[model samples]
Target: MASGDLAVGVVCLSQTVVGLMGNVSLLYHYLFLYFTGCRPRSTDLIVVHLIIANFLSLLSRGVPQTMAAFGSTLFLNDIGCKLVFYVHRVGRGVSISTTCLLSVFQVITISPRNSRWGELKEKAPRYTGFAIFLCWLPYMLVNIICLMYITGKWGNTNSTIKKDLGYCSGEGNNEISVSLCVPMLSMPDVFCVGLMLWASSSMVFILFRHQQRVQHIHKNDLSPRSSPESRATHSILVLVSMFVSSYILSCLLQVCIVFMDNPNILAVNASALISVCFPTLCPFILMSRVSREPRLSFAWIKITKSPKPIINM
Candidate 1:
């Protein structure tokens, strides 16, 4: 193997390992809380879902891609190809949906008593369970088309077009599938992105009002640590920004993967490297956010009481 390929393989391996460990640690932490009779907070449930999706995504996409990068060609079969791509897409969709739900849930949690969404805050726990459960339907349905067309390179042979030997390729005359599948796959994402942005905007407004109140009440005590709400607001904002940026970058790379007829190994390697960052970084980001406040930090709060109450609404 070339030094460059070895380097890429090393990076992919490291990312997959780190991401899996981080997410698994978080999962274990939450499950421990639940098993000990500590009632898991609604936000804990959401975090669990997010962690599951990211872990699966890393496994399906990162593991196989890493193996391939390291010169393993075992996944040249139709079933393996189908399974890898299917899991990756489904996990990606679930990750996006749960994130948007998280943003909306947090926004509702912080709603003013007089606000229309104030009533929603109380029922958010139930709604979160429902939302995360239902979010899989659209993504699952859309990716079903993948089983029909996506397969090993041999299955991609057609009279008009040739397929890449390096990656799974779909049927040649798949215009109908492309027309239907692309929109089905993307529509949920578009809607989720919109919802996340709307919630983030509302959060910004609330934070502004909160800041005004804080300044008026304690003008001399300008420390940011005085308010856990501000710390949470900052954390969520950072999470939202990171998720959006990573999601957009992945989408663009996928577009390139789809449109580029003669993609070189370098392009493929670059895409794989960039794609893993979101899942790899997400758990650490959550850890960092949870560390900001002691009372609400992950340290003192067991399963019973979450410091920030992310899903209170």
Candidate 2:
């Protein structure tokens, strides 16, 4: 109601709007070029999947929260509440699944043959869909309870609204929010996030080992071409790190907010929202390694030394 509160709300809402649009645009361009204009390359498919995941997350969470923050009205009714939270919760959970699949697929693709790890690579595609399906199925079930509970009830003098709109449980009830629903759904949340954490850790460790081995392999005789496999791992690993880092930090902030009972909500939202920007940064990180002129020079020299490739193209 105060001027200061309105100012804070505007600033926080603006950050989410700008970050979401910028990242989505960057990712869309990359996906367009990769899928249609550019050559069919090795990492192209995986990157496309990553773009889809982040884009979904953006639309689901970023858009709803941004609208609520900026718009004159809140979730107008129960249906609106369910719509916003469902998109936010379901899409958020999907990110964990998508990241985990991205990690495992990278590991399997890069694993040395003759090792047990190689077996997984053979079955990668079949398992990827199954993993994504399993990740989504539980969220769907658990959030059914949430759908019933999360009504767009108004706040009063006795209880409070954090910013403008009110979510259910403003007037908290032990049996409803905590005892019956939160406890039940939290079980699945823990399992899903924990599995993702374990998978991400394993993937990161394996990536480091692979990178170290490659260090020794790099030499005069080693060709100018970098292993496209390692490059894929690098991009996915950056994505995982960015997601995990921002997520863990936000989780910590959430815990502190619980204990401290601070009125601030926007900071927590901003932190999580920034996590969406990782998709935009993903291509730039990959492109940092790709040299435009050197690639051009390589093509020129390749033609000069051997012109047959030009005729083939």
For candidate 1, report its TM-score. Answer: 0.86
In model 2, which residue pairs have backbone atoms overlapping below 3 Å? none
For each candidate in turn, the TM-score is 0.86, 0.68
Which one wins on lDDT?
1
Model 2 CA deviation exceeding 4 Å by range: 1-53, 71-75, 153-171, 175-180, 187-189, 211-226, 253-313
lDDT of 1 by residue, 160-183 (tens): 444342456555545676678777
Worst 10 residues of 1 by lDDT: 292-301
Candidate 2, 1-313: lDDT as tens digits = 5554455446545555664565566566555554333444333454455556555666655555545455434444657666766766666666666666666666667777776878876666656556667767777777776565455643334344222222322223334455566567557656646766666676678768866776766755556555656566666667677777766765565444333333255554554455445443554554543433144344445556763554454
Query: TM-score winner among the candidates?
Result: 1
What are the clash counts of all predictions, listed in order?
1, 0
Per-model CA lDDT versus the true structure: 0.75, 0.56
